[model samples]
Target: MLVVKHLSGEYEQRDPRTKAYATKVKDASLSFETFELSQIGRENNGRADALSRIASAETQSLTGSIYLTEAKMPSIEKRECLEIHQGTDWMTPLKNYLEKGILPMDRREALKIKYRASTYTIINGRMYRRSVSQPLLRCLNTEEQHQALEAVHEGICGEHLAGRSLAFKILRQGFFWPTLKADASEYAKKCVQCQLFATVPRQPPEEMTSVLSPISFAMWVVDIVGILPTSMKQAKYCIIAIDYMTKWVEARPLSAITEEAAKKLFLEHIIL
Candidate 1:
């Protein structure tokens, strides 16, 4: 039996304007001509003359010698071989085979994903592993690296750094805790950014007063304010309040400062 083996090489479609479709091969651009019996006398009792005669009779174009080979039947367990003819397109057959389930779809998908994932450019001449989350080339600076490290650390702690308000605070202050070396707990505690921005300030408990203030409904403290408006459309008047003991301040907006309106606004905000 005669058999042919396909070679592995880069293949590309030819341009219609520059190349003839009839002469162009699918998947490859190289020209290929079928040779005469290239193998003979390598099999048991194989005659070189007989093989050459057979080749001549089969193709009628004998341009090469006839070599012989042992008849090794293809194994049933072996995967189907893809015959990539020289100067002939193999993409159609390949696509057919893939669509018909001759080729494993899952394996092909996995291979495609692997190829896409591996297609990444190096940064700063340093070989870092490719990943979807990896920073782009232009953004690969010292500050970006610090941010990335911080993000990774935050992610490990089950938090998303980018979504957190404290992220801007931490980045603006340029804070980094030495978690990898020395005492991580102590380092985190001493981080100035973490203390001033990331962490909420802890207020000492207010001292308990022995006497209680008399209850006066709607008789609440209020603030009045006026300022010139900027370019943006915004009101100038504002009000703020503070608890007597807690000292926590709350600010609100006010349109007018009439005595009756002020009393009603104070009652609505403080009492209600």
Candidate 2:
């Protein structure tokens, strides 16, 4: 048997027999955004645009290992793009100082070498690194860098793509970060959708637990449950007792539960 309560704005009382009837309840729902949907859409669009920009390069089809993004192509020349980053993440201050022409001790030492000196240089409030054929596009900030990776890996233009492909696409589009490949791989592995659809593991991590109760009636458990439909006798709750060793069970219904009722049940069912 089931009890139906009217949830509609107006308070209602119905006869006991009307338990099966449905009552309209007032709408009680709250709404807020957990993440900015607009921002996600923008990221997807950016991914699509980047993919489109590299569509020609993708057609060359030499090997999956090769990147064909416009940013990574050999034909592209070195350039600098300066932008401010706003975040408390670790990379913030380092990038800030580099863009401001302040090199850390390690970079200063490395820059002293004639060959390595041209590797890192500042232009127009931005840090630029000259690679083999093109300058690495210093990522604007961590969020934008993450967004770029996510866009390439799982955004609209992405078909839930793999880490390698995602990283390649981002690189081709001219973005550079410290752990580009590693970050892309980790992100792909952690994608909730990918995990949801992934194949199940064949092996269990641990062995199953062995049962400890060896004899019947060796252990017992008891509990009260329910705001059940009130019967003609006004019983709307039940007290249940179970013997762990024997799997024996007993129950009694009640309209109300009290210390006296519980004591009575315990004494009658277990103590006796």
Candidate 3:
């Protein structure tokens, strides 16, 4: 059981100076009111149920018209409300809330949808965001596309196209995809700037097995050069170990090849 007491008091009539001070003090009091409701557990189930029933009944009886005015009401049609709540026509209330400086969750969702719609592009039979200048440049075939894609591929693999879009936006003036797939592929493959930075030398396929000589260090065939200067481990000179009987030749580097290294190679190939 709870008891709440309400006490009332009246202020005495005051002098002008005193009245002004009192009015000022009253005005200075905090303008906002705040309340909090707390639920308490009861020992008895029956008493709790009765209290809950009473509370529910009181709540149902206290209902009244919300946002109703005595004077002329603003035009809010029932159909509009139904559309906002049920159907996908959500612009009006969102705009109203935004205009009133209120940011609702629904408004944020609508804003996301609008942003995505504005930034989206269709490429290779799939829809992607036009957040990148490259995709737009790909559409427009602008001179800046190569530079943008180079920067994108530098930091990101082709797998993370979405993440690279922001980088493209930072590089050049944003545009739409204008180039065909073949052109785009050629640009990616041939971009000199990207090749200088990110391209790796491809390893050549192994040659078929050939016959070897019998004796060790007998027919020492020395091939001066073969492969290009751009190849990885660019060997300019080669020392070949050939077997007289087997007629087999094993060629290796001569630039930095040491005696121990050659001996190790000979042991692996000949001694074993």
Candidate 4:
């Protein structure tokens, strides 16, 4: 029933997000003789939610007297920014031309800078180039380009995309460099994992997944969804059964996870 694991000592709450709210609840609970917290689904809690909304919305419309208070400040502190030194790179000429009208002494180069600056704009000290599909593409300096390449190719959520695809993906994410595609290609070529997992043996049109054939509506998998908000009927969990081959799914809301509840759902929904 306890959603705040740290407050109940079930587990140490390391998440700053929930821990802050949970701490306030724990402090307030001292005023009560006995207090308990339970999670319920939105379907059952809609009545109370609607009441709160009415109390907060259009107070003038309601003849009944009501007073509301709003929090003036954010719950979390502002994120800290890291200080880094940024030296000039290929974009310097374009940025200078656009911001300050600075141009190279060479007449030929100055004309080129004017043409390039037409495609770029500075926003809050950051440069962005005009894009057709996207409104703006963020211009990255040398250091930032490296970070972007590493992040897109090898960072936590990275899929280790090949050279050309990796470059396009970074562009899609609104980042750009003078040699983005070339750099991405070189970075991918140097990546250890990319080298190890390089696509090979072009016999089949696509890489084969499994040799064994699977039958439709045969094997199934079951999973429990959560300790959700408690419903008026006291249900807070969802049990789901999915057919692997057919991709058919069935679900039932439950108050608690139990063998009998699972069996009941299986008998009623899946087996039948």
Top candidate on lDDT is 4
What does candidate 1's lDDT look like per residue over 1-272, in tens digits? 22211111223425443233323233243434542323334565456556656633655454467444544752223457999755422222233343342443588764654453343333454322333544332212344445554554353552333233433334333432212223233334555555566756467588666633354331334577676353243556667765545555666555655677566655776667
lDDT of 2 by residue, 96-121 (tens): 45555455467654354434334555
The lDDT of model 3 is 0.47
Give TM-scores for every candidate, taking all chains together and pairing residue i with residue i.
0.18, 0.34, 0.18, 0.43
The deviation in Å at residue 127 for candidate 4 is: 0.5
Candidate 2: stretches off by over 4 Å: 1-117, 198-272
**Top TM-score hit:** 4
Better of 2 and 4 by lDDT: 4
Worst 10-residue stretch by lDDT in candidate 2?
20-29
What global local distance difference test value does model 4 have? 0.85
| Candidate 3 structure quality by residue, lDDT tens digits, 1-272 | 21111111144534555454545444554454743223455665576676456543645454464232233532221233433344322233333333443444786765765554455444564333354424343233344455555555444544222323434443344433434344445655665555566546576577667656565555554343434353466665565676666557876665554576577657787558
Off by over 4 Å in 4: 1-87, 202-272
CA shift of 219, model 1, Å: 8.1
Model 4: colliding residue pairs: 39-229, 39-230, 40-229, 40-230, 41-229
Provide the lDDT at 86 for model 4: 68
Count the clashes in each prediction.
Answer: 9, 10, 19, 5
Candidate numbers, best lDDT first, in rank order? 4, 2, 3, 1
List candidate 1 segments past 4 Å from native. Answer: 1-220, 228-234
What TM-score does structure 3 among the candidates reach?
0.18
